[model samples]
Target: MLRAQRAARPTAVRIDGIVKSFGGACAADGISFEIERGTIHALLGGNGSGKSTTIKILAGVYQADAGAIEVAGVRHDARTFSPRQAWDAGLRFVHQQQTTFADLTIAENLAIGHRFETSAGGRVRWRAQHRRAQQVLDQFGIDADPRDELAHCGIATQTMVAIARALQGVEQGDERVLVLDEPTAPLPPGEVRLLLAALRRFSRDGQTILYVTHRLGEVVEIADQATVLRDGSVVGRLDEGEIDHDRLVELIMGKRVQAVLSQHTRARRGDVLLECDDVVGGPVRGASLSVSAGEVVAVAGLLGSGRSSLLRLVAGDLRREAGAIRLAGQPVDFSGPRHATDAGVAYSPEDRLASAAFLDLSVRDNIGIASVGDYFRRGILNHRAERRDARRLLSEFWVKAASTEVPLSTMSGGNQQKALLVRWLRLHPRLLLLDEPTQGVDVGARAEIWQLVRNAVDAGAAALVVLSDFEELVEVCDRVVVLSAGRTVAELDCDGLSDGVLEHAVLSAERAAA
Candidate 1:
């Protein structure tokens, strides 16, 4: 009977001629696609290429100007669809940002958005809720206790809990479809493997998934079919047999771009701009590194290797326990981030959404906020000068926005990152600290960011970057510093660095230390 029902309805989601326009920009222009039931379908696109807009339309967050959406054997006009309607049609979404409360228990977080089990008197049944949450967790193979605080679990476990929660009310025979947007963006490589394995399990159990991500390798590994969107239009589609890395890159980029890092040769290497002498703070233990003027140094390590800790210590986000840091040969201890910023230093954190960007503010304000002093007159802001500077920075960074007045939340992740970088780079600091600068950005924007970093170094500012992508380290860094177990293990020049070489070096150091 289940097989018969599956045979009768083949498509889980069918979107036709979806069109969405934001003022003068047509985000989704005549987009069309179909996801077969019980298969993993991938949506690929560059930043501001209408991928998010189309997904939002399907999620009923935005009313499309014109389109038809058929989900779970139910059809709804995109022009008048609502969130409740989408929910009733069995569509669930796990957005890029995590949607869980750290302070709450796993059971409580799972109960959110779904109808909680309650007593006849309308009081919540805590015991039954924990059992139900545990069942969902077990179903997804997530090793977490329902009664445990979500903050106690690792990031990977928290992510799986969020996914399991989304599938809580869904029954075995229900024609529900899950949409995951960049689910693995924040995870480490090992955690990503675990999450993909669980997703494959869901696909095997006759569940349909629409996975959106910038990681092409994961797409080839997990997706059965892929639809590529470029500039608000469908450019290519690939079946399981055709989903190779090179082919997908060509389709999404519209060019055969090599992933090789450019060999950067600085014309003049000057004195040390920033130096960490036996820095010991947070997870860092006796770590030491240096960056010279016109040089870009990258810290490379696996998860828990203290890469982020080193950066935070230098940026003054963490207090140094023991050791000293010198900037431009002057020994200085920063009391806080503001002190760091005041002393000719700039830091771009890894968590862009939480730390770097101001979502509620306009793009103009985000870009020009740090430089407000330059546009001040007798304690009054020079509005015209501020806007003019914002416009110039927007144009210079190639941010795709209709105008500066729009909220920063409206722009794509890549554009927001560019704006954030522009915000700090305008300071012309003596030292720059960047953590995962292009973690969620698409390929095209990545090149632009690399150029921006290079430009900064060329203008005599030194940079220290922490990245998980070894390929990016090979391309962007003049030297790579490997850290293991909170200690500096080895330092290698990037003159002939390859991904394999860097990985082998880090792993070899880990094995030695073990």
Candidate 2:
């Protein structure tokens, strides 16, 4: 009877007055929302908007301070919900970093999360496991051999395997809800369409999904219901017809903002500040582009098309095998990043927590560590001057934090990115190399970060950025350079560039290469 009741319920999940706080900061303040069964519901918000906190609570990663959640018509205390309970309640999660082993076979990857079929004699049943894996793959429209290694599959296939593993055993009338947090962040444009199609198929077959992403276009295309959260509270809820780019942005930002990057106006281009000719390094083969002072050029391409490798070669992080680089009309070859830094070139990598930021260090230290010599006097470090500059730059960059003395990890992802930018922008580099500068950041911080880049470019610094978000690339860039299979395939002016135009340029390059 209880199973029948759960199957009959229209709503899949419900949150009532969910509240979570950390160190006196309320992350989620009495947030309440409902997700109907067999629908794609998007939980939209900016960085530090409490949507993450709410998801963490639902996943049992963090116990809420107060509230309750109803899963399949069964109410449970939020504070005592464990991960085991979530799994038992038919809740599954596929995070941005999927927990699949690249070296394992597809069948092995599938069996890792669930149990493997075994005989009473304690022997493994490989055939049964392979058969079940093949069934799941076929069910999700994944075309791959179950016995093949997952590493041999494309990124889209790997992601589908991850999703299939997550949705294992979650069938019709199961009242299951799959939570996908930025699943498409690591995927390229072509792969994103493949994943979204699979998701829509699941929804059509009675699967409920809670999709969290910063990409508004995907939300518009896939979401059936939209719940916007701001500063830990429910701001607005939009039905399918109500979800559009402008309306969603207005609700997420709590203002009638025209667009996320609507405020950007192109800056005047000066003389060519940095030039690359036939650059060949790592995966970048014959990649070439030029950036002028006060100009922003963006690299757009599919994954492994050498977008990042090109940036690394230009930034002196990778060895240029066969290419000539000219900075200010002077031929230059940098041996390392220090050489680049000394030569007025600043580069910020994509991974902040791993490469850029010192999580254990204070914000002041993280910003000042790169240029500690500026604070030196009488053969001793001057802490006072460093603190002063840190505070000034924090304010200048619009990094919101309690104080400059707090640990860098205490701040949000967006602030961490801004803080890193503050470090580079303070150096006054003649050319800035930014690879996915706004990759993980939310829309609000994304705007602020681009604004900062523009300020630097306006101050005579040339910027070459690699952005996967084509909309942002179209908005913030002065020119678009398309790369394919380690080659510069096309270059388009951003004067009238649309997302379709940019994507078509990239796709056309890939298709031609194929």
Candidate 3:
């Protein structure tokens, strides 16, 4: 009974001949797809493969220049419907990057999509709205008090608020269409599975999900049908039975040799370059570790794992409640990121917009932000030296852009990440602290970034890398430190290690919840 009776079900969405472009580059070209009622249809592709563009158009963020969108068989001009209209038509989109009023309470965030009207007496119905929101939160296994402020919660909880807001229109009589874009990337394994199960529960209730993700294994696991896009065109749409990871990769890349990526190897021996002496922080407890030069050391665990907090403490972005950090066998006092930098440490923060780049500033300024000392003459920025310095790293890192003078935000997401990396790499630090370095980068660029990290380590600088992709840990890291709920549970050495062993160690290292 739980089989694909799509032919018997009503058609939820029908897209035809959607075409869009930017800067003369094709993003979505004559793309066509159909979503059946009560199905989780996945849009899978590389960063620039047009998947995001198609999703953006569906979400009313972008308009299709030459296409038609039909929701519940009602034809749309694609460009005419405003965002509010899309919502009115039962389209709820959850962006991968969670957006919320950080200062607002959880209850306030849940009531965001409520349709309010003034009563005759001008009375408010806030109580009824909060109760309705309570039912929604209960469905997601969230038992926290609604009065809790959103920013005070963990990233996963904040993401859940976004999920609940997107589901607000489900009780309406219209066809329920939900679009979730990479909602699990920021989550750890346990939370990721929990969210995936929630999605499956939603699917069972006749909700149509247009899910977009880069994790191929997840697509194969959860998608009712997989749609592959390459260079802005629909290359393949595979039903559940016909899709596998290899074929999926080939479909996105338009060729073979991708088969080798799964079986690749570049492991080598290196010397220890950094050691943490019972490193202690608010979230990280008694975390002792040693990382070698020319080695990629990874911190692996579930979402609330002390991974990011550990890196932040080491880089001096957080207050060290106790313990210490050593670089090249020398005791270091990292009072702040500046102190860390002065000690030849380069850290790429997690939130790029807030911590990494001056978004509105020129790429030249963002790239030269960290080590502006070299391009400054007695506190005054030397424009000529800054241009030369920015250009040198821009080319070295293979950042694709018109010129160094262009604004950092104007560049693609991958390029911005590259610029951030360049900003730190120029420092030639003894240690590199990369927190989700390639979070939103494209696959091709992801490989390049990996190479850049490896090249830095190979150059004799110790590296501590934090990645969402567990496979990336096995691929590039020589040693992995497993953190569980803000504690170091195990240290898995990569010497003669297989992917299976690394994964098991990471999973098994979890301490019993206290």
Q: Which candidate number has the best lDDT? A: 2
Ranking the candidates on TM-score from highest down gives: 2, 1, 3
lDDT of each: 0.86, 0.88, 0.78
TM-score for candidate 3: 0.86
- Cα displacement (Å) at residue 61, model 2: 0.9
- How far residue 176's Cα lies from its native spot in candidate 2, in Å, is 1.5
RMSD of 1: 4.0
lDDT of 1 by residue, 332-445 (tens): 888876789899899888887888789999999888777778987898888998898888888887887779999998888888989899988988988989999998888878
Q: Which 10 consecutive residues of model 1 have the lowest summed lDDT?
A: 1-10
TM-score of each: 0.88, 0.95, 0.86
Name the runs in model 2 displaced over 4 angstroms. Answer: 1-9, 119-123, 260-263
Cα misplacement distance, residue 189 of candidate 3 (Å): 0.9
Output the worst ten-in-a-row residue range by lDDT, candidate 3: 257-266
Clashing pairs in 1: none
Alpha-carbon lDDT of model 3: 0.78
lDDT of residue 358 for candidate 2: 95
For every candidate in turn, the CA RMSD to the true structure comes to 4.0, 3.5, 3.6
Q: Model 2 over residues 225-261: C-alpha lDDT tens digits?
A: 8999999999999887778888888888887764445
Expressed as tens digits, the lDDT of each residue in 1-514 for candidate 3 is 1344355467899888999987776778999989888888988877667887888788778988889889997889876656876887788888876777889877778766564333678764667656766777887667666778898877777777887777764664459688888888787655676677777777877778898887777787778888888878899999878878888878877775343233435445466678887788877887888887777788887666688888899888888888878787887768888888888888888897787689888988888777677766777878887788678778899887779987887676777888888888887888999999878665666777877877787788888888767766676677788887677778776656775676666667664544
lDDT of 1: 0.86
